[model samples]
Target: MNNIKIKKNFSPKTYLHKYVYDDIRPIIKKKRKKVKSCDFKIVEPENYKNIVCINYNVNQLKQMCKRYKLKVSGNKSELMYRIYNFLKYSYYCIKIQKNYRGYLYRQYEKFKGPGYKNTKLCCNKTDFLLFEEIKNLPKKQLFTYKDKDGFIYGFDICSLWNLIYLNKETKNPYNRNQFPEDMLYKIKRIVHIGNIYNYDINIEVDKSDLDILSNKKKIELKTLEIFQKIDKFGHITNISWFLNLSKIKLFSFLRELIDIWNYRAQITMETKKNIFPPSGSPFNNINFMILRHKKIEYIQEKMLRLINRLITYGKNEEYCKLGALYILGALTMVNNNAANALPWLYDSFMIVS
Candidate 1:
């Protein structure tokens, strides 16, 4: 946006103990003055006629927008923040905003008290997953019709051998500075655990947790060890890589694109359903952990609620494991409740989500 810059020195700005993401209310809230209106004609409670937005009205916001030539299409919250940005920063950064209340509170220790110790969202566990950084494949290249040997080479995949990366520039470098928001490609959560969209799995994980992944479903990390294709002229025709992972799933956004006049990201089939992950063998059961909170009600974790409803209400075992012919999940809510509350709740998974 021409008028605003939310990032300072290649990093997101923090205001009011919260990360500013197109929302400037926190800054304004911090600056709000509790002033009393100096009017004898009308008796009022403290700060009845303050200039701050603590006492807000639609007309005031509109007037501010008109006076500043700001866009008037946003909701009141958006407009309030926009005007605040204009007044304070003299610019308006219009980015997709995410809810950071939970995170900010945790950072500030808002949830810490005598009753609560080792809480899930309030703390970070030491045992987080550690993902190996798979090198990014080279930027796609067009097929060379003829090489020095006069042999035809229409693709280049062989150079994938030296999969070592000294420094890289394939994916957006600074985007992680804005993680879980500006996602290019990431593995969704599987095995009934974690947020489906959380790709921040590059940390070291516990071995027991790793076993859960292996038992549920794994592409076998060994399979990703060797991947290469050389053209007839000893030229690199195509390249492939595992860009990032969420536990078991290794995800790559773009493969070495094959240039057939234009470019199309290649998906070499280990089998027919080349791009999509194949389903595990049938009759494999999926179960979640169930536990009771200290002297509190029992709450089951994972999809127990849904599974129970489907089982009892539907009235059939077949319905319990019915046709998803292929379960393609775009959005999933795999949360932990009291039932699955291990000594550590999802190992601070809820907070990460």
Candidate 2:
């Protein structure tokens, strides 16, 4: 008997490009401005738009052809002509009338708040002074940097590590500017790293209550009081700080913390279920009594709510975590909700895989 070869499903290397193009294509077509007949000049090799102009880079053009399942064996000009013609035809044929309104509505819903604008609050001088204050802090003191106005800044260890790495990599040896552009770039990149971590996390940085003149000593005292109330644990010894970092960093830190909490919650739930069985026998009244326990019921409800929140507000990576949570029965008594969980688990799997 001949064995059948099972084909493995894998994403094409151009998936990111294709996904982005497909997403923006509808909006582009709907908002396309009317052009005169004179505007339809022959697309020269040098004159084509960046999106469609590929002939200039022979290797890139060939890769694009292969990505689109087109004839890859062609001269640079020939490949460019083929890509240009394909894009031109596609541009003309785009019809989003039926779906354009819905797309716009969805976008409006997604970004109904302050939107993705990067607002500048304090001047460069204030930022430079703040950086100077915190930059020379010892490793232990790096996590907590209190500013004036009683604001105690904290940072994620992971993000701090990345920032340190970037600083070492791009340290300007010759120039000694107070706030170098390269250092600023590193800081901004650290914050923006959250977008790569999760999508639902807001990218906006809130600076409504920042004060540069508030006594750092008072802020440190208040932070110490707060920390006293909260018991220290791994990574929890210092709370994630948001001051001075861009919107991306703030959101990424929050998302990372939430994910960590979710993981802990899952482990706690599994341990509780294993140690204390809610069901023992089909005819036992004690099994029913165990389900009625307030502590068990409370934990289950919290787990359900946390998982739902992660599913609703989490990014692609969070979705993957949610899928694992559901499949592994992270919440005890998930059998009752397994029907609903299956769809979410499958959806997350498809997205991540």
Candidate 3:
């Protein structure tokens, strides 16, 4: 048996080359993040180092030629290069020629999808025309340009979303456990409480009135007064006014006031948490830090002090008004200077008479 002699040749240069290639290849490796559910396949170039030609889906190539202000027929390679350059320069991320082809394919796919995403109409159309007009217009005509009056004319779309989004506050009335009468009384208490602070607002209920006409007329008059106040001064203001008055005649105003206060309180809470869109000004790139625990602790201390004062001299005419004022003031501070605060304070002071 003749044994075949085999030579195992391992060289230092071969090992060194392997290591160098491994280290350097990573620098030139594909960088694009893998896009999910992309319609186009990435086809790599065989001859050129980093170039690729993309075969279009249907009339996509024709569309591309049209897009770059070119005729749809002939000079295919030049049109392809134009498309490549457009993507590379415009997006700034599509550096490789293959990346440009893949992007165009993806955009074409998206344009043809059920809901066209990121696809702009041609410059001739109404939407695009209007956009161009706005873009070229002087800064004075624009809504929120820095050179303009700094007033944004449009609604905060997010705010409108929140305002109309949900009806979470409407409690279920059909539940056997939920007593409508009890809820009604609680609402009535809130009304009474408000009226005690604002004596002038209360409806006049004469003890001498036994006639049905007089009683009916008194109720009607009181209802009109409350409605008028609500129309003039908003819910929170009316509630504060009611709370400040003496409980003279609050028939239906009390219910409306309670509902309004509850709504406002919820709104204030939402605003503080940034759950609701801002009602004031446009958001700017401003930075500020607030220590939440520190603020809450400080406010809690003030609230406790006010509660103690209210408990101590709530009955005495002189101190009663003062205590009410203090409580309202503290609540106002806790609510972050909400607009309703002043009304509450004013109503409390009105009952000093």
Local accuracy of candidate 3 as per-residue lDDT tens digits, 141-245: 111101122221211112112212221222211111222233223223323433443422222223353243343333333333432332332223222233222
* Model 2: how far residue 198 lies from native, Å: 14
lDDT by residue (38-128, candidate 1, tens digit) is 4212211232222234635556667667776878777777766666655543322222112343443343232112112322221111111
Residue range 294-341, candidate 2, lDDT tens digits: 443233333333333333332344343443343223221222233243
The 10-residue segment with the lowest total lDDT in model 2? 231-240
- For model 1, give the RMSD to the true fold: 27.6
lDDT of candidate 3? Answer: 0.31
Off by over 4 Å in 3: 1-63, 67-77, 89-353
State every prediction's TM-score relative to the real structure.
0.15, 0.17, 0.17
Against the true structure, candidate 1 has what lDDT?
0.27
Cα deviation at 336, candidate 3, in Å, is: 31
lDDT, each prediction: 0.27, 0.35, 0.31
Using lDDT as the measure, which candidate wins?
2
**Segments of candidate 1 deviating more than 4 angstroms:** 1-22, 25-53, 91-353
